[model samples]
Target: MRILVCGAGGQVGHEVVNRAPGFGLVALGRNRQQLDVSSPEQIAREIQEQRPGLIINAAAYTHVDNAETHAEQAYAVNRDGAANLAAAACQAGIPLLHLSTDYVFAGDARAAYRESDHTAPTGVYGASKLAGEQAIAARQPAHLILRTSWVYGVHGHNFVKTMLRLGRQRDALGVVSDQIGCPTQAGSIAGVLLELASRYARQGTLEWGLYHYSGQPSCSWYDFAGEIFRQAHELGLIERLPQLSPILTAQYPTPARRPAWSVLDCSRFEAAFGLAPRDWHADLGEVLVELSRLERRPLEAGVRRA
Candidate 1:
C-alpha cells in the first residue's frame, strides 16, 4: 500500500519516509515546500494525484514560544490545516492519521492524563492543536489523532540536539526541573505510525480515535539532559559531560506557558492496538549512536581531522 506522509522534512516524518519500505509500504513524502497543508486546494490536488491508501498529517506549527505572538499562523496550520486534511480524506475515502501534542491539557493534574480528560490548554500552541483535533474528529470518522510529548531525534532541531550543542559550548547549564513529560523519540513515533498503517492495510479498518502514545518512564528536562550527556559521553559523541543545574520554570521564562505535568495515560491505545510504548532509555541510546555516527562521517571523509 502507498501512504502519503506530510511534513517529510520533520524529525518524525523523515523517519517515517525512510522506514516505510521495511513495513511493505510505498511512502510518498512531501515537505512544507511541496505540500502546504494550510491550503485546501493544494491538499485536494495532491490527494487526487497521489491516490494514497492512507494520509498521515505530520505537519504542524511546533514552535511553542513563537506561537504566543504568532497565533494566526499557528491556527492557520494547526487548526485550519487539519480541517482541510480531514475534509480531503473524507472526500477521498481514506483514513487520516494526525500527530498531536500533550500540551492539550493544562498540566495541573496530579496523575497521568487520560484521553477522556478535560482539555484546557494554557498557551496558543496547545489551544491551536486542540482545535485541530476537534476539527479532525468533526470532519472525519476514520481518523487517528495520536498525542505525544517531548519528541527528539537525530534528523531535526529538538531538545536532544540543543543539549548536545550546548553541552559542548558551556561548562554549566540550567534546565527546568518542574516540567515533566515522556521524552519520546521521533523514530519510535514513526515506527508506531507505520505499524498502524500496516495493520490498516491488512485489516482495512481500525479503532480510529484519539490515542496517547509516548515514551516510558517520564522525567524532568534536567533529568533528560543528564541522560543525554551521559549517553553522548559514553558513545564518544561529546568530550565531557557538562554540569547540569536543576532550576524552576520561573528561572527560564518564555513567551508560552509550559505544562507543569504533561504525562499522558496511553493504556487505551495499547489495549486497542496491542502495541506497548517502547522504553525511552533504549530509544535514547539508539539516537545517541546515530548522532555519534553522523559526527564521525565528516572525519571519515577527511573534512575534519582527528
Candidate 2:
C-alpha cells in the first residue's frame, strides 16, 4: 500500500518513514520543500502525483512559545493546512490520519482527559490545533485525529534532548514539577500511526473519529528530566548527573501557558484497537540507548548541541 506522510523531517514523521517498510508499506514522506501543507495547491499537486492509498499528516506549528507571536503562521499550518489535507483526502476517497496534541484541553480535570472531554485550550498553540481538529472533522468524514502529549525522540528537538543538553552543560537544573503530562516517545506514536494505516489499508474504512493516546504512567517535567539523566548516566552519555530541582510552573514563565495536567485517557483507543499503552520508563530507556548510540562520537567530544 502507498502511504503519504507529511512533515517527514519531524521526529514522528521520520520514525513513520523509517518504520513503514517493515509493515510492507510503500511510504512517500514529503518535507515542506517537497510538499507544503500550508498551500492547498501544493497539497493537491502532491496528492495527484502520489495517488496514495492513505494520508498521514504530522505537519504543524508546534513551537508553543513561538506560536504566541506567530499566530497567523500557526493557524495557517495547523488549521488551514489540516483542512487542506482533509479536504484533499476526502476528494481522493482516502483515509486521513492526523496527529494532534493534548494541549486541546484546559488541563484542570482531576482525572485523565478523555476524548469526549470539553476542550478549552489555554494558549494560541492549543487554540490553533483545536481549530485544525474542527476543520478536519468538518471537511473530511474519514479521518483519525490522534492526540498525544509531551512527545520526545532521537530525531528532533524535544524535552528529552533538552534535558540531556542541560544536564551535560550545568551542574544543577530546575524543571517545572507542577505541570504534569505523559512523556510519549515519537517512535511509539509512529508505531500507532502505522498500525492504524495498515488496518485502514486492509479494511478500507475504520471507526474514524477523535482518539487520545500517550505513554503510560504520567509524570511531571522534573520527574521526566530526572529519568532522562538517570538513563543517560547509565548509558555513559552523561558522565556526571546534575542536581535536578523541582520547581513550580510560576518560577519559569513562558510566552504560553501550559496545561497543569495533560495526561490523556487512552482507554477509548485501547478498547477500540486492542493496543495497550506502553510503559514510559522502558520507552525512555530505549530512547536513551538509541541516543547514546547515535551520539557516542559527539558525546566523546564533550556533549555537542543536538
TM-scores of all candidate predictions against the true structure? 0.98, 0.96
lDDT string, candidate 2, 133-225, tens digits: 999999999999999999999898999888888887999999999998998999999999999899887888888999999999989999999
What are the lDDT scores of the predictions, listed in order?
Answer: 0.95, 0.92
Clashes of each: 0, 0
Model 2: lDDT of residue 70: 96
Worst 10 residues of 2 by lDDT: 297-306
Which 10-residue window of candidate 1 scores lowest in summed lDDT?
297-306
Off by over 4 Å in 1: none
Clashing pairs in 2: none
Compose the digit string of candidate 1's lDDT tens values, residues 1-306: 999999999999999999999999999999999999999999999988989999998999999999999999999999999999999999999999999999999999979999999999999999999999999999999999999999999899999999998998999999999999999999999999999999999999999999999998889999999999999999987899888899999998899999999998989999999989888999999999998888888988889644
